[model samples]
Each structure stands twice: as C-alpha cells, then as structure tokens.
Target chain A: MKIKTFLAFVGPSVLAMVGLIAVPLIGVVYLSFHSSYVKTEIVEVKSSVPLFGGLTKTTVEKVPQPVLDENGEPVKVWEYVGGRNFDTVADPGGLVAAVSKDRSTTEDGQPTSFRQRMDGLYRDVTDIDFWGALEFTLLYAFITTPCILVLGFLLAVLVNSVVQWIRGPLIFATLLPFIITPVVGSLSIYWLFLDNALVASLLEQFGAGKIYFLKDAISIRTLIVLYGVWHVTPFAFVILYAGLQTVPQDALQAAMVDGATYWQRIRYIIIPHLRALFSFIILIHLMDAYRIFEPVLVFGSNLFANSLQYLTYYILNFEDNYYKAAASAILTVIGICILLLPVLRRTYREQKGVA
Target chain B: MAMTRDEKFWEGMRWAGFGATFLFMAFPIFWMILTSFKVARDAYSTKVFFSPTLNNFISIFQDPYNFGPLLFNSVVVSFSTVAVAIPAATCAAYAFSRYQFKGKNALMVSVLSSQFVPPVVVVLPFFILFKNLHLLDTRLALVILNLSFVLPFAVWMIKGFIDALPPDIESAAVVDGCNRFQVLRHITLPLIMPGVVTSAVFGFIQSWNEFLFALILTNQKAVTLTVGLMGLHTDKGILWEHMAAASMLIMIPIFAISFTIREYFISGLTMGAVK
Candidate 1:
C-alpha cells in the first residue's frame, strides 16, 4: 500500500480518536488546574409594603446575584487555582495532620510506639476519602483477579470434561452472567439480598436473625467484590476454555500414564499452558475493576464504599464541579497506569517481537 | 475406557462442581426472569411458587415509567455508534495490517493506551464541551462520546482478524488488473465480512451496555436503557417486579444477539490480547 493510500484509509479514525480522546484528555488536565465560575455581585433592592391606611413602609436587603450579559446568560469568569481542586478532593493536608498527630500521641495524648503509629497511619489514610477509595478499589481489583482466575479455570476444566451435548447449554448458562448488562446484573443480585428479598428471608428461615446487608460497610463491600467475581469469572472461563482446546492431548495422556493426579496435572500442565490467558484476564480485569462504577451506584454502596471512578462521578454529577472531578479523574488515570505498568510493558515487548 | 473407582469419584466431583457453578451463574438471571412475571406481593418473598402476572411489564411501559422512549434512544444510539465505528475501524485495521507506514507503531500504541484511560477522564471534558454546545440529552451526543472507546476496540479486534488472513487473495486480485481500492472492495471486504459483523455486534454491545457517558450526558430526552434503570427507583420505593420487568427489557436484545454470535463472541473478546 502507498503511504497516501494508507493515510487515506486511516485518516478518519485517527481524526476521531484525536478529536474525542486525545483532546479531551488534555482538556481534563487543563481543567484540573482551573475553574469556571459565574461572576456575581452584591445588589440591594427595596420594596414598599402598604399599611392599613395610605402609608407605606420600605426595607432594603442585599443579595449576591450572578451578573448577566446582554444575552441574559450569566457572565462567567475563569481562574487558575493550582492544586486547590486536588487538595479539596484529596484532603492531603488533613491526611498528613491526622498521621502526624497519631505519630506523636494517642487520642488521650499519650506517647505512641511504632506499631501504634503504623496502625494510626492506616486509619488516617482510610479516613481521608480519596486514599480510602483507592484502597478499596485496589483491594477489589486484587481480590477479584485471583478469584475469577481460579473459578474460571475450574469452570473451563469442568466444561471440557463434560459430554459434548451438554457443553452448549453449560456455555449458555455461563455466558448469561457475563453478558448481562452490568447494572442489571448488579441490580439482580442486589434485589435478592434486600431485607425482605429471597436471600435475606432464607437466612431468617434458617434461624438467623434479620440482617440488613446493605446497611453495613463490610457486607456491602463484600457484596460488591462478590458481584465483581461473579460477573467477570465467566469471561475468564471462556477465554481459558478456548486456550484449553489447544492444550496437547498427548501431554495429558503421558501425564495420566505417569500416574499424575488431577490437581497435579492442572498445576503443571494446564496452568502453564494458560499462563498468557491468565495475564490477559488480569490485565483486562484490573483496568475494569478500577472503574467499578455501575455496581457502586446500583448497590447504593456509595455511602459505605466508593471506587475511584465512583468518587469522580459523584463529584462530577452530584457536586456538579468539573474542575474537582477532573482532578479526581486525573488521579484515577495515574493509579491505573501504575497498576498496569508491568502488564503493559510485557505486552509492549511481545507486540514489538511480533512486529 | 471404562471408569475406575477413582475416575468415578472424580467424575462425580466434576458433576457436583458443574451443578454448583450452574446454579451460582444462572440463578440470579433466572430469579430476574421469574420476578418479572410475578405479582408485586409475591416479588418480595422467597417462595418458589407464585401466581405470576404480566401486569408489572404492562405498568412499566405506561404512565410515568414510559420506557418506550428510552428503548428508542438506546437502539438509535447503539446502532448509530456501530454504523459509524465499524467502517472507520475496518479501514484503519486494513491499513495497519497491509502497510508498514511511518509512525504506525506509535499510533497503534497510542490507540491501545487510550483504551485503559479511566472513562471519567474523557467524560469530564466532553460533559463540559457538550454543555457549552447545548448537545446534552441528545442521542447524537451519546453516539459521538461512545466512539472514544468503541473505535479503539473495533480497530484492535478487526485488525486481529485481518492479520489472520493470508493476503494471497488480495495479491491475486491485484495481479488480475485490480487497483488497491477495487482489491479491498472486491476481495478483502468479502473475506473479512465475518470479522466486520463480529466487530459490529461487539461494538453494539459495548455501546448498548455503556452507562457512565449516558448517565452524565443525558437527563430526559435521550436516556438510554441502562441509565433508564434509575427511573425504577421511585419515591414509593423500588417496585421490585417492575424493576425486574424493566431489566428484562434492557437484557433481552443483548441476550439474543450474544447467543446467536456465541462462537464469535469469545474470539472477538480475546482477539486484541491474543494476537
């Protein structure tokens, strides 16, 4: 292909990507350091009140009102506030103060030891909203990654061992959870655990007391992680199952002849065979679990637990401040890049080799 | 081969695991389908038996919970996004596969890296831009915003398919007095038609299932089905059966499309990573 031809074919997509993605990324970074506000001024007005007779009384009060242009839209002012939005969103000073205060003394003002100081550091970091959200998001990603991989591998093995006729239905059953819309999937699970719903009622029927699963931080976080694993494990299963079809049957036969146990074969042959797919799943899962937004909304877990994406969203939508939201969003992006650095480097090397 | 006692034990365990896995994976969906048909009173219970009714579905489509417009918006937005993304992606994928152009690797790497950017980063600026342009709450806004992720995905997926092709057919067409355009149109397009369709379906699902962009960019006139789920949270409390019914509406089309393309779905998902 000529260079012109290649450019002609690729131009539109490159343009769209640059216009939509690259430009917006730069804009987000720019907005993080600046804020737009409606210009306002204090104005006083007096209104007369009629008495019973012809006399009247007047009073004046001042109020801050947005200054409008000739077009009647509010006049806007743009100002740069370096790191203020970041500070507002992260509360870093508060975090440092909390940690230092703990380092010096206990709550009752006694001197603290190293272990106690470490414990207080942990508490202080989590108490700050941004650090707490990062902790939960990372924990969710790490916990769900292994669970999904193991369960998914086991599922692949079971499906591979099953009769051919049942495999289709089994795949269908597994794909339902994976393919269902995330919000709907999370909502379905959330409905079952509601106080009067099926799961809660079943627990009570089995002699447990009434439990408010959604009310507590621990249970809600657990449910969120469970939802993550349940929703994503099928994806891993499908990919690994595809990998399984390529595993050499002769190697398995040799293992069987050598009196290898099932677990031993899985540990030695199947795992090493599917190692690439494992990393693929982990890479995708980490990227996704960091942006765990819909479940946080559907499960109403924001009051108890917030993912980094959810915090950005809460600031963007509920607080309706783009600057702070952009600051939070930039931090979230940095976190993902850090989390994915190793996998991404490995992938880049492999792609370069292939090229 | 005949099964020994140990083999029999392992087979039994496999069956048990299969059963457990099936129940865990399918039960929530089954419960969803079941509740969508149940009366409001029975929906909150744990009973396996209930007098089911279609009234919940009927009610959701009427009055304040008018899902008809939402359904329309979702279909329009998703289809428009795929229609726009697939062609652009196919062209780019072909270029990347067939040509060794300058800066190709840099461009490809940038495309791939953009996929991992947290969506909120892009959405924040788009939100502000769309607000300034008064494009909020329009299906067009959604279609354009969705391309940020969908185009990259479609490019990588379709490129995977193109790379797998041998290129012999295109060379033959070129030797037989075909220009590059004619060769691509006559030969390569037909060869990669299945890939194109697969990418289309995958892109459609991504667009349909998208939540965050639609959530922030839309309010009233252009709510997609996924965002429309929020409507079920009424002040009277979430009407469970009604919500179930609405969820079915959101899920049924995706379920249908996925089942038909089950074979391609896995390949499309792993195409970027594997290749």
Candidate 2:
C-alpha cells in the first residue's frame, strides 16, 4: 500500500524528468550519429494566369524538392557527401595529410610521411572553434575555481565578526555582483575596459594610452577569467560563511589561550572543521563552472574566448549546422560527466549508507 | 569573544578591510546607477559629477525596444515555472523525504546529477522539439526549459527542508485514520510552507536569470528581460546610459525579493550542503 501511494506522490516529477530531460538526452545521442541529407523529390506544379493572350496563360511543370518520408517527415537522411559535420569539428582532417611551409628539407623536396605532414598541419592550424572552446572552458574552470575559493575565504573571514554594526550592509553589498544577470554582470566588467570608461581613463592617467580590453585575444580571455572570479566568489563566500558559523568556539578559544594566533587557529581548527563544507562548495562550483556560457557572450570574445557551451550555440545558430551541433553538445555532456565523476562518487558513497 | 590588545588591532584592521571590500563589491552597481542617471553627453566622460536626468528610463520604454512585453514575459515565465515546478518538486521531495522505497538513493542521485548537465546540451533537444511543436517564442517554452533546471534544484532543496521536519506529526496523522494524501494536506504541507516558499523563490530566480535557453527559444515575442537587455546594443555602439537604465529595472525587483528572503537565501542555494 505504501509503495503504491509513494509512486502516486512521486509520479509527476519522474514523468516530467523522463519526458523532457531523459528522452531528449537519448535523442541527442541518437541524432548525433545521423547527419542531415537532402534528397531530390519530384513535385507537380500547375498555374493559370491571364497573360498577353486572351487564352490565359497556363503552366504545368514538375519540380524537384527535398524528399519527405512516408509520414511527410524529412528524417535528416544522413549526409556526408559535402562533409561529415562532426569530423569538421572534433577531428578536422583527422585522416588527411598536408605540409606546413612547403619548404621542409627532403631529397626530392617532398614530404616523406603522412605523420610528418599531419604534425605540420597541426602546427599551421591557428584556431578551430571546437578546440579553442575546449581550451577556454578548461582554463576558465581551473582559474576561476581557485580564485573563488581563496577570495571567498578572505571575504568570509573579513566579514565574520561578533560586531553586527557593519555586517548586514557588507553582506548585502557582496551579494549585488552575484544577484545581477550573468550577461549584464559580465558586461559590467567588459564595459569598464572600454575607452573613456573609468578603468580605461585610470590606465591612461598611469602613463598608458587609451586601451580597449576586448581588442586583443589575450585580454579578452583575461577579462572573462576575471569576470568569472568576480561573479562566482559571492557564492563561495556565502557557503564558507555559513560553514564558519558551524565551527566550535571553545576549540578556537582553547587554541587562542594556548598562544595560537588568529591565523594559526583558523589554519588548524577552522580549516579542519570546515573541510566537508569545502568539498561541497567545490562540488557545486565544479559542476556549474564546467558548463560556463553567458559570460562568453558578454565578453564579446567570439574570436578567441568561446567556451564549449558557446561553441555549441555557435554551431547551431551561425553554422545552421545541427548535425555538428548535436555532436558538440554530446561531447560537452561527456566533458561535464567526467568533471563531476569524483563528486558523483562521493555522493554515491554517502547515499549507500543512507540507503 | 573576548578581545586583547593585539586582537583589537586585528579587529580594527579587519573592519578596514571589510570597508574596502564593500566598496569594491558595490562600485559596479554604483556606476551602473550613476550611468543610468547621467545625461547622454556626459555618459562616456570619466567625470564623477554630472547633472542627472531620468529621460533614459522613459526613452527605453519607447518604440524599437518595447521592453514592456519582455518584462511581462519574464514575470509570466518565471512565475509559471515556479508554479508548476514547485508542486511537482514538492510531491517528489515529500516522497523522497518520507519513504525508503527501493532505488530511492539511485533516483535521488539521478535527479541531483541532472542539475549539472549544461543548459546547452539540454537546449539542443529542446530547440528541436520546440521547433517541431511550434512552441518557440511562447512563454510555455521558457517555462518548460526553466523547469528542467529549476525542478532538480527545487526537489533537492525542498527535500532537504522536508527532511528537517519531525516525523511524529506525519505519523500521528497517519495513525488517526488519515490516508497519505490526507496526511500530506493536513499535517505536512503547513509545516513545510516556509521551505516551499524558499524553494519557490530560488526557482523563480533561476528561471529569471536563465540566459541560454531563453536566447535560443525566443526571438522577439516572448523574450525575457535578461535577453531584452541585449537589445539595447544598437549599431550606433552600445547605449551605455540606456543599458544602465534597463539593467537597473531588471535588477531592482530581484534585489527586493532577495533582500526580503535574505534569511533563507544561503540555505536554499547550498541546499543540503550546509547540513
């Protein structure tokens, strides 16, 4: 009876998840393997109109359109004659050979091996959307994660006080950066580096000329990494601050009485006590950061700072390339899963005991 | 909490640091507000002082931008998501919290892990599905997409809250000839109302701030405020003052909501992490 009732209670949620998320995800994988195809279809066209003659012009013609299936559906039809979409992205020229410089020394003045030619091809390749995006994604994740941890720790420690006079407003102030839309929040940072803005003016005052931070690829990437740290630190600060409250005061007092400085007490008692909290924070941050998107949009770094998520959007929106988009989306999902494996393992271990 | 001479020095230094940190934190918002009020000619200048005008606000609400529909869409989408997701999440959360069914752990783990899947991956299938159904540019699409993220978060958070409620009340109602439905309606719902509200607010904000899915799913008619802010970037370069005004309008309500619900904010965000 309880089992029947439980299913009734939970049925809607499970149904919704299975319908939207699970089914679509499976569809993503299925669709990724099949590329779009255009099949010429014969069609009958008839038209009548009054023309120069009183007989009224009449036209009948057979035209060709893309073929539809039995259900009048296009079926994507699986095309690779133009090019395999996924290969153009994830494995561009994977099976091809090309030389760099065309001047490499050889007795016959020709490249000797496909392996050498491929190596030179790789050297000559300056940027590709999929690979650059992956690079930016990892760089953003690694740099921002540590920055949030350290900066959030400082903010937490800075504001964690017995004095209530200033804590309230300070907490509210810190929350502003986080509470804004991610697009607008990143834009706020991006705008500051534009010419005639305050930050740019400050740079000019300090013997630097007018500079737009979004101009260069490196600066664009730097702004994104910096924007990420600025945006995510509030979350870390809030979590760590909550964790700090859980520390036992007597332990800290005992350490203080034993001649431990504030730093020493925090290093020994506080950090050790808050280790679980740190792991939880890290887990949340890792999952969120690995799927980073909107910041790249505001940073205007389409040329260099595209994240994997951004690349997925780019593939579909600009390329009109659904086949490759599905493949990239699947690749991104795999990347997220790999990143979260350790966190998932820990959660599974804990849940086993709960069970 | 006793203070010594050395500790006093550190305390003073700490307050000073917080003062600086507070300024750093608040400066962008200060500038945003400052720009919103600045006259157009003075917007690009570095001068801190200028005569202010409210024309930017009124002008943005005029033609070509038409932010009114976008704001309406944001409200409807966010509220509709919370409305749907909250009840569904509550039902699931209650089940997870109250029962020990087989594979309960597995179910919970799967639900929680879904939260980590990037919106882009999710958006891919949604884009195709919505295109076929002619659901694009409708508030329903945003609500449905919002539910994918907000549902997992809401379920986890609501479950955590429900977990803290005492079992005695539920069991007592059950003993008093109450069916599971009756017990949930009579005894459980009232007890967990605060959690439900907190979860609702969190879900609301998640949908409100959601960018990727909305950007892809809606072109003009059902655009949310988060995307509408982008429309301010015209060919004549970004209208800094106009964006500032639009942004302030975008942020103020969420700020008000966050401030009012400030107490439960962290607990809701971290979900079970704090416990």
Candidate 3:
C-alpha cells in the first residue's frame, strides 16, 4: 500500500484522536500551570432610601461587579500561576511541619523512636488530600488485583472442567456482574447491605448485630473492594480461560502419570503456562483500579474514601477550582504511568521481539 | 478412567465451588430484577415473597421522573458514537494491518497508551472547551468525547482480526484491477464483518455504560442513562425500587448485546493483548 493510501485510511481517526484526546491532554498540562477566574471590578452604586413620608436619602456603596461579555456572561481571564495550584493541592509545607513535629518527641515527652517517626510520617502524608486519595487508590489496586486473579483463575478452571451441557448457562450467569453498568452493579450490592435489605435482614435473623454497612469508613471501603472483585473477576476469568485452552494437555497428563496431586499439577503446569496472562490481568487491573470512581460515587463513600480520579473530580465540581483539578489530573496521569512502568517495559520488549 | 477416593472428593469440591460461584455472581442481578418489579414497600423489606408491581417502571417514564428524554439521549449518544467510531476504526485498522509505514509502531503505541488514560484527565479539558463553546450538555459533545476512547479500542480490536485473516483474497482482488478502496469494501470488510460487529457492540457498551464523562459533560438535556441513575436520589432519599427499574433500563440492552457476542467478548476486551 502506498503512503498516500495509508494516510488517507488512517487520517480521520488520527485527526479525531489528535483533536480530542491529544489536544485535551496538552490543554490539561497547560492549564495545570495557569489559573482562570471570572474577571471582576469594583464599581460604585447609588441607592435611594425612603425616609418617613415623602423624604428620601441617597447612599453610595461600592461593590465588585463581574465583568460581562457581549452575551452578558462573565468574562474569564487566565493567568499563569506557576504551580500554585499544585502547591495548594499537595500542601508540602504542612507535610514538612507535621513530619518535623512528629520527629521530636512523643506526647509523654519521651524521645520518638525510628518506627514511631516513620509511622508519623505515613499518617501525616496520608492526612493530606492528595496522598490520602493515592493511598486508598493503591490499596484498592493491591487488594483487588490478587483477589480477582485468584478467584478468576479458580472460576476459569471450574468452568473449563465443567460438563458441556451446563457451561453455557454458567458463563451467561457469571457475565451478569461484569456486563452490568458499574453504577448499577454497585447499587445492587449497596442495596443488599442496607438496614432493611435482604442481607442485613438475614444477618439480623441469625442473631448478628445490626450493622450500618454504609455508616462507617471501614465497611464502605470493604464494599468498594468487594464490588471491584465481583465486577472484574469475570474479565480475568475470561482471559485466563482463553489461556487455559492453549495449555498443553500432554504436560498435565505427564504430571498425572507421575502420581502428581491436582494441586501439584496445577502449581507446576497451569500456573506456569498462564504466567504471561497473570501479568496481563495485573497490568490492566492496576490501570483500572486506580481510577475506581463509579463505585465511590455509587457507594456514596467519597467522604470516607476517595480515589485519585475522585479527588480531581471533587476539586473541579465541589471546589470549583479548574486549575487545581488540572494539576491533580496531571498528577493522576503521572501516578498511572509510574504504576504501569514495569508492565509497559515488559510489553515493549515483547512487541520488539514480535516486530 | 476410574477416579480414586481423593479424586472423588476433589470432584465434589469442584462442583460445590461452581455452585457457590454461580450463586455469588447471579444473586445480585436476580435481586435487582426482582426489586424492579416490586412495590416500594416490598423493595425496602427483606421478604422474598411479595406481590410484584410494574408501577415503578411506569412511574420512571412519567412526570417529574420523566426518564423518557434521558433514555432518548442515551440511545442517540451510544448509537452515534458507535456509528462514527466503526468506519474510522475499520479504515485505520486496515491501513495498520496491510501497510508498513513510517512511525507506525510509535502511532500504535500511542493509541494503546491512550486507553489507559483516566477519563477524568480527558474530561477536564473537554469540560472547559465545551463550556466555552456552549456545547456542554449536548449529545454532539458526548459522541465526540466517546470517540477518543472508543475509536482507539475499535482500531486495535479490528486490527487484530484483520491480521489474523490470510489476506490472500484481498491481495487477489487488488491484483485483479480492483482499487484499494474497492477491495476493502468488497472483500476485506465482508470477511471481517463479524469482528467489526463485535467491536461495534463493545464500543456501544462502553458508551452506553459510560458514567464519568456523562456525569461531568452533561447536566440535564443530554444526560445518558448511566448518569440518569443519579436522579433516582430524591429529597425524600433514594427510591430503591425506582432505582432498580432505572438500572434495568440501563443494563438490559447491554446484557443482550454482550450475550450475542459472548464468544468474542474476551478477545474484544483484551483488545489484541491476548489471542
């Protein structure tokens, strides 16, 4: 194919991506360094105050008036702030103070030990909004990745080992949690744990105490993690299930002939064959779990736990700070790149080999 | 082959695991569907047996809760995004598959990396741009934004399919005096139609279930079904029954579409990462 034909074929897609994705990403980076606000100016206004019958007094007051455009909408002015937004979001100064304070002594006036100092630093950094969100986001990623992988592998193995007649229905049933909208899926889980809902009522009948599942931070976070596992396990199962098909039966048969137990054969043969897929699932899961937004919203757990994505969104919507949101957005992107660095390097090496 | 006593035990355990897994996975969806048909009181209660009602579904489409427009918006936005993404992706995928060009690997890598970009980062700049252009809360804005993620996915998935094909037919057509476009339309496309449909359904699912972009980019006029779920939160508190009904509206189509393409679902999701 000629270069012209190739260009023509890929032109629209390339253009759309550049215009929407590449350009917007660049704009986010640029906006991170700048601040925008509705331009306002101080102006004097005169008002007549009615006195007792026909008498009136004039008063002059100064007020700030938003500078409006031809369309009567407030005009916005953008000025470079040079990382002020980043400073506000990160609070490095406060972090330093907190660390230094913790390093000095305990409340009993005893000298702080190395372990205590490190603990203090951890607590201090996480108290900051940026670090706090990052901590939970990483926690979600770390916790859910292993759970999804193990459960998904087990599921794949089970589904694979099942009789042919029941496989179709099993796969169809399993795909429901995954195929449902994230919001709806989370909502479904959320409802079950409500005070009067099925799960809660069942627990009540079994003499378990009435626990307000959404009332506390711990339970809410647990629900979020549970939702992640329930939703994503199918993805891992499907991929690993596909990988299972390619596993050589001779290897398994050989192990069986050697008097290997089921666990032993799996540990030696199946896991080794699916090693590449394990990393693949981990890589994708890490990228997705880091975002972790819809569940946070659906669970109404933003107050208790916020992901990096949610932090940026909260700043933009609740705080009405686009500059700060942009700064955090850039930081979120950086965080993902760092999280994905090892997997990406491996993938790059493989691609090079294939090429 | 005869199983040992231990093997029988393991076999029983596997069946038990399968049953447990099936129940754990299916119970939530079953509960949701059941709740959608129940009255508000029954939905709130733990009683499994109750007289079911369709009133929740009817009420969602009526006054105040008027989901009719939101449903319309979701359909239009999802269909429009897929309609635009599929053709462009097909062309790009064909080019990448057949042609060896300069900077091809770099371009492909960029396309692949773009998928990992969190939507919040993408939406920030778009929100500002749309606000400036008065395009916020419009379906056009959504269709355009959805393309950013959808088109790249479509390209990768479609490219995987095209690469898998023998390409002898397309080459033969090209040699027999059919132009590149003619050959692509007549030969290559017909062969890759299944793959293209899978990508289309996958893209549609992405758009239909998209929450953040729909949340941030739209307010009322263009709210998609996923974002429309938030409206179920009333001043009186969340109407659980109505929410279940709304959820049904959001997921039923997705479940149907995905079930149809279940065979290719994994391949589509992995987007050429796996075979």
Candidate 4:
C-alpha cells in the first residue's frame, strides 16, 4: 500500500485517539503535579454589561477569586506541589513528616506513643478512605476474576453440551447480564435482597434470617463481587466457547474413544488448548477489575466501600481537588500497570519463542 | 438405546446445572420487567402476583422523569458513533489486515490496551476541555468522547473479519486493472458486510451502555438513558417502580438487538482471538 493511502486509512482513528485519549492522558499526568490550594492574591479583571437602548457598560469588577484573600485577593491557588498530591493517598514518609510536624498536638505532647503518632499521621496524610478503597479494589479484582473465569468456562462447556436446537435461546439467556447496563445490573442484584424482596423472604424461609445485604460490609462486598461475576462471566463464556470451537476434533474424539473421564479430558485437553484465551481473559479482567467503579456506585456507598476509581472520583466530585484527583488517577494507572506487567511479560516471551 | 445408570445420573445433573444457570442469568432482568408492570404498593411487597398495570412506564415518561430526551440522546450518540467509527475503523482494519508495516504490532497493541485505561482518567481531561469550550452537556461532546472508545474496538474487530477473508478475490480485481480504492469498493466491502454490521452493532451497544462518559460529560439536557436511570432518585427514597420502568426501556432494545445478532456475539466480542 502507498504511504498516503495507509495514512488516509489510519489517520482519522489515530488522530481521534490522540486528541481524545492520548492528550487527555498527558493532561492527567500534567495536572497531577500542580496542587490546587486556597491562596490569597490580589488580581484585576474586566467586566461588561449590556445596558438599555443598546448601550454597553464595561467596568473592572473586584472579582475576589477564591485563590485570592480578602482585600479583593484570590484565596485559592494552583500551587506547583510536585508529588505532594500523591503523598495524600500514599507516601508513608510524608505521613511520618506530617505526624512529626503535629507531634506537639498529639495528646499531651510528652513523647507521643507509636499509636498516637500513627493516628496523627492517618489524620494528616494517609487518607484511610482511599486506602480502604484500594484494599477493596484489590480484593474485588482478585476474587471476582477467578469466580467469573470458572463460572464462564463451566457454563460455556455446559451450553456446548446442550441440544443444538436450544443453543440459541440458551446463549441469549446467558448473555442477559452482560447486555443489561452495569448500573442497572448491580441494582437488580441489590434489589433482590431489599427488605420484603423475594430473596430476603426466601432466605427467611430457609432458616437463614432476613439478612440486610447492603448494610453489612462483608455481605455488601460479596454482593458486589457476585454482581461482578454475574455481569462479566458471559463475556468470558462467549470467548471461551469460541476457543472451544477451535479444539481439535480428532484429539477430542481419540480421548473420548479411550476411557478418559470428562474432568480428566477437560484438565488434560481443553484447559491446555485454552491457555492463550485464558491469558487474554486474565488481561481483560485485570485491566477492568483494577479500575472497578460501577459496582461501588450501585451497590456500596462511596462513604464506605469505594473502589480506587471511586476514590479518585470522590476526590474530584466532592473535594473538587483536580490535582489530587489527577494524582489518584495517575496512581490508579500505575496500579493497573503493575498488575499488567506479568501478563505482558508472558506475551512478550511467547512472541520471542514464536520468532 | 439403553442408557446406563451413570449416564442417566449425569443427564439429570447436567440439566439441573443448566436450569440453575438459566435462572441465575434471566431472573434479575425478569424481575425488573415484572416489577415495572406492578402498582406502587405491590412493587414493594414480595407478592408472587400483583395486578399488572402499565402505569409505571406511562408515568415515568410523562412527569418529572421525562425520558424522551434521554432516549433521543442515546440513539443519536450511539448511531453517530457507529457511523463515524465503522468507516474509520474499517479503513484502519483494512490497513492492518492487508499491509505489514513498521510498528504494526505496536499499533495493534495500542488499540487493544486503550480499553485498559480507566474512564475516569480520560473523562478528567475531556471534562476540563469541554468546560473551557462551553461544550459541557452537549451531545456533540459526548459523541467526540465516544469515538475514543468505539474506534479502537471497532478497528480491532473489523480487522479480525478482514483478516479471515481471503485476499484471492481482491488480487483478481487488482489483476483486472482495478485500483485499491475500486477493489475495496466493489469487492472488499461487499464481502465484509456481515463483519461491518457486527462491528456496527457492537459499537452501538458499547456506546449505548456506556455510563461514566454519559454520567460526567452530559447533564440535564444531554442525559443518556443509562445515567438517566440514576436521575430517577427522589428525596424520599429510590423511586423503584419508575427506575424499573426506565431500566427496562434502556435494556429491552439492547436485548432485541443482541438476540438479532446472537450468532456474532462470540466472534465480535473476542475480536477473532478464538476464531
């Protein structure tokens, strides 16, 4: 192909991505450096008003921006704080420094105990809320990825085994969770356990007392993971089932002719055949689950069970701290990158081996 | 044919598992649809059967929760995204499928990995830019952002289809003195029509169901249906019936579309990884 033709073909999508995705990504990294804080600086501004009879009035209004102080000064400022925004959520050294700065205020101030120092540090720098979300984010990613993989693979095998006539209906039914909107899907699961809901009533009848699924952190976390699996497994199933189609018929038939049990055949043949698909699924899940947000939004309140995505969002939405939100957003990217390294390394090695 | 005891036992177990899977998948959506048809009082209770009324659907559309605009926004944004993305993606996909260029693998990986970046990271910049341009709450801004998402997947997916198609016909067309563009128009496009439709449908679904972009980019005027469901919250508590009604409206069209393209679901989703 001519270079011009190639560019013509590839240019629009690339430009769209660069303008929309790449530039914005660079913006997040750039915004992470400058801290938004209240600063007091006097500034002047021009103003204009349309008066009666098509006349215009222009005046310098004393617009006291929040970065400026009282004397018609700006009170808020975008201070270039370097990585200080990152220290708010992470930065143990910064936490210690914050504690040391406030040691005099630590409970009577006479050689504060370790616990007191830690508590003070938590207050000063370590946002427990963000850390809590980080913890749950990891937990959700690990727990739900495995659950969805297992269920999806299982369901795919079952669906393939079913009578051919029913396959279409079965596939549509299985994909329902995936097709439903994520927020609404999570709400459906949450609503199932609502007071006087069918599941709640059934649990009572089953001698397990009506459990308040939402209020209890453990149950809510489980509910969120369950909902994740319910929503994502279908995608995995579709992928894995497609992989299964590529399984060598001769090999399967040979194994079937022998006395190999179903489980044995799956373990020895199907699993190995699915190794590439498994890796792809893992990469997708890790990339997705590390940035978990919708479940937290729909199932758990940001007050208690925020994901890392939610943590960044809370910083932006409530605190309106763009710099801090950027820092958190960058941190989230790093977390996902860390999770992605092993899978990427494996793919690289496989490519080299192929070469 | 005489079945052994072991075979009979396995048959029952398999059917049981299938039944369980089916119920698990279908029940939540079934409940959503069922609840939307119930009256306010009966909606709350765990009653097996409630007098079905079409009131929830009618009420939500009429009153404060005017979903007509939201639905229109969704349709416009989704269809527009597909319209722009499909052709652009097909071009890129054709390039990837036909040519072996420098940095081709890297470019493909870049497309794949774009999916990994959290929407929050991307939304952050778009929000500021849109605010600066006074384009916030505009469907145009939403469409512009939606392109970033739909383009990559569409490119990769259509590339899969074009790759699977034999190059023999195109080569013959070239031998007949047809240029690349003519060959693409007369042969390549007609051949890849199913793949195009599949990519278009997949892109539409992704754009339609996208929540964060819709939630953040647009507000009252340009609310898409997914985030519009969240707006149904009232001061007292969640208006469950109305939300159910709204949820159904958002999902039923997706269900119809998905069922129509059920055969492509596996291939379109996997982007030809399995095939």
What tens-digit string does per-residue lDDT give for candidate 2 at B111-228? 9888877777777888888999999999998888888888888888889888888888787778789998888777988988888999999888888898888889999789888898
List the candidate 4 regions with Cα displacement exceeding 4 Å: A36-39, A42-79, A91-127, A205-207, A348-355
What TM-score against the true fold does each predicted structure earn? 0.94, 0.89, 0.94, 0.89
True contacts kept of each: 0.78, 0.64, 0.72, 0.72
Q: Report how far off residue A344 is in candidate 4 (Å).
A: 2.7
Residue pairs in steric clash, candidate 1?
none
Model 2 chain A worst lDDT window (10 residues):
A94-103
Model 2's TM-score against the true structure: 0.89
CAPRI category for model 2: medium
Chain B TM, per prediction: 0.96, 0.94, 0.95, 0.96
Q: For candidate 4, lDDT tens digit of each residue in A1-355?
A: 7788788878888888788788889999999988666654456787779999999899985655455346865555566788888887676675456656756444555787778767666555434666667778888889988888899999989988978999878877888898788888988887787766778878887999866766767778888888888888998998898888889998888999998888989999999999888888888888888888887887646655679898888788778877788989999998998999898777655544532
DockQ of each: 0.77, 0.65, 0.73, 0.67
Sort by DockQ, best first.
1, 3, 4, 2
lDDT of 3 by residue, A149-176 (tens): 9999999999998888987667767878
| Model 3 per-residue lDDT tens digits across residues B1-275 | 99999989988998899879988888888898999999977887776788988899999998888999999999999999999999999999999999976667777777888888889888998898899999999999999999989999899889989988877878788889998889889999999898999999989998998889989989889998888888789999999899999999998899888887877775676555555
TM-score for the A chain of candidate 2: 0.80
Clashing pairs in 3: none
At residue B65, candidate 1 shows an lDDT of 92
